[model samples]
Each structure stands twice: as structure tokens, then as C-alpha cells.
Target: MLRGRARREQAAHAGGTPPADDPLDAAQERRVRAVLALGGVPQADLPDGVQQVRLRLLERAAKGEEAPRDVSAWSAVVASRLALDWHRAKRRQERLGERLAALRQPEHQPSGEDNRLLSLAVARGLDGLPDNQRQVLVLRFYADLPVRSIAEELGVPEGTVKSRLHTAVRALRARLHEDEVV
Candidate 1:
């Protein structure tokens, strides 16, 4: 596959028109062949469609419609984005499958070490804090809210929010260090 791709690249660099017999450049043709040969794809699968899209992209590239001088870089970015989309779709499908499987199975309780030590420590530190300090920490970390948002939510000034967050963080750090020692 690599050799075929190399040959195609060489042909492309040679500046000859793509052969009438082979619609794709040598590398693209090899990629199509490799994808078809993979058992994962049925003969009628979208590998051919993907190849066609890639070829079109390449053709556009060759015609200088796209950044031809940085074709490889652009192609890499396109391929990476495509792969990321595929993975995200796959993950969504897997989550749906897991939900269906859970519906069919008996309810299962979680059984593991109570990993809430950090939570407990933080809670203890928070309990010892003034209400404003606790609110700042809860908004910033627990709710994942931004400082400006927290300030708006609490109807306070942004500087006040920053000050509270700073104090909360310092207190938490000291508490966490003491917890580690004990």
C-alpha cells in the first residue's frame, strides 16, 4: 500500500495528467484498494464513496482551487477532522447501546472504595469557610461557572467574586495539604 502511494505521489509530482485508465492518482488508487481489501468494509460499503470524495478534494487541490502549495497539510487537517467526527458518532452510538443494555439488565449497585475523600475534604474546608467563600468555590468548581457568571448570579461585583475565589482556593489548598499529612 505504501509503495503504491509513493508511486502515485511520484506520478503526481511528474505533472502528467492522471491516466485515463485509472481515474485516481496512484496513491489514491492504492488507498481505495486497501480499504476495499479490509474485511471491515463490504464491497458495497462507503469506502468507495470516501475515496471519491478524497479524489475530488485532490482534484480541487491540483486545480489550485485550494492551497495547492500546502496540500499535504490541508489534507491532514481534513482527514483528522473526519476521523474525529467518526469517533464522536461511534461514541454516541455506544452510549445508546449501553443505555439499551442497562434497560434489559437488573439494577446493579456500585461497589468500590469510597473515592469521595477529596469531596469530603473539600466539603469540610467549605463548611469551615464563610458563606461567600463557599459560594465562590461551589460556583467556580462544582458548577463549572465562570467568575463573571458567578458574580452576576450572586449579584455581586466581579472583583468581589475574584477575591472570594482566591480566598477559597487558598483555604482549600491548606486543607488538602493537611489532609495529605494526616
Candidate 2:
């Protein structure tokens, strides 16, 4: 129908997917949008709700079912249903995000004694590393020096600094595993 085509063109111009050859006429589309907006659907999602209603109407036609006796009323109901579904989905996402945030929080806060013991173990581990390895490790970790800066400060190539850092961390990890300090 000319009216359907015109509505599709208008939808296209408004940055929505044009419901090409849709069953809903212009007035019907307007009613669908109004119903969706009034049902608490956000403005940005109104076009999508309208498209859903149009798709359902076309789907009925595609299935060889008789068109609804009252197209406007049917579209309005469909739009309202879509709006409710959207709200339900939004609430579900908010609940899921809250659950994830709760999971990320620490269940038991570390005690001061635990932190002190860990710090002592780490200091002892550092003391056991070779001089060059220990120097680079301290500069990189404690002093928060980058690889390039470490190389420049120590007058060593960047690759050499990286190799030392890797070997040192491996050795320290092995030592910690052997001591059961971690």
C-alpha cells in the first residue's frame, strides 16, 4: 500500500529499520509508537517496539492467518507487551550486575598480621635473589620504574632488563612455593 511504503520511507529517514511492505498503515504506526511511549518505553526504543509490532503482524500474514479484525487495537496491545518485556529485561540486567558486584567484593578482609607476614616473606625472597636480578626487580616493582627507564638507569639494553626481570620473578616464585609462603 502507498501508505505503508510512505511510512517505511519516513522510518528510514529517522534512522530506523524501514519495515518494508509492513501491514500497519501510517496512523496505525503512530498509535503503536504512542502506546509504547506511554507504557514507559524510552524514546530511543519506541521505533524498535513499532518494528516488533509490524514484524508480528507480517508474521501472522506469512502464516496464512487472517489479519486481526482490528489492526490498530492489535498493534497497540503488541506495543504495550513489548514495553513490558523491555522493562522486565532491564530489571533482570540490573539484578545481574548487582550480583556480579557483590561477587567481586572480598568476603573476608585481610588482618594486619596476615599483611605483615606476607611483607616479611616478600622481603626475604628479594634478599635471596642475585644482585643484578634484585636491583632490576626492586626498581621495576617497588620503585615502579618502566622497562625502558630501568634500562636507561642501569645502562643495560631493554631486552636484558626484561630477561632479568623474568628470570628473577620465576626464581622468586619457585622460592615462595618451596617455602609455602604463598
Stretches of model 1 off by over 4 angstroms after superposition: 1-114
lDDT of 1 at 64: 72
* Best candidate according to TM-score: 2
TM-scores for the candidates: 0.37, 0.51
Clashing residue pairs in candidate 1 (N, C-alpha, C atoms within 3 angstroms): none
Query: Residue 176 error for model 1, in Å?
Result: 1.2
Cα RMSD for candidates in order: 16.6, 18.5
**Candidate 1 residue-wise lDDT at 148:** 91
Model 2: per-residue lDDT, tens digit, 50-129? 88998899899999999999999999999989989888878866766776566446678667786677678888889999
lDDT of 2 at 136: 97
Predicted candidate 1 versus true structure: per-residue lDDT over 1-182, tens digit per residue: 97997788668645644544333554654454444344233345445445554675757867878544544444444444444545565666676677657744656543333236655777788898888999888777655567898889899999999998998889878987888822
lDDT of 1: 0.63
lDDT of 1 at 69: 55
Q: For each of the candidates, give the backbone clash count.
A: 0, 0
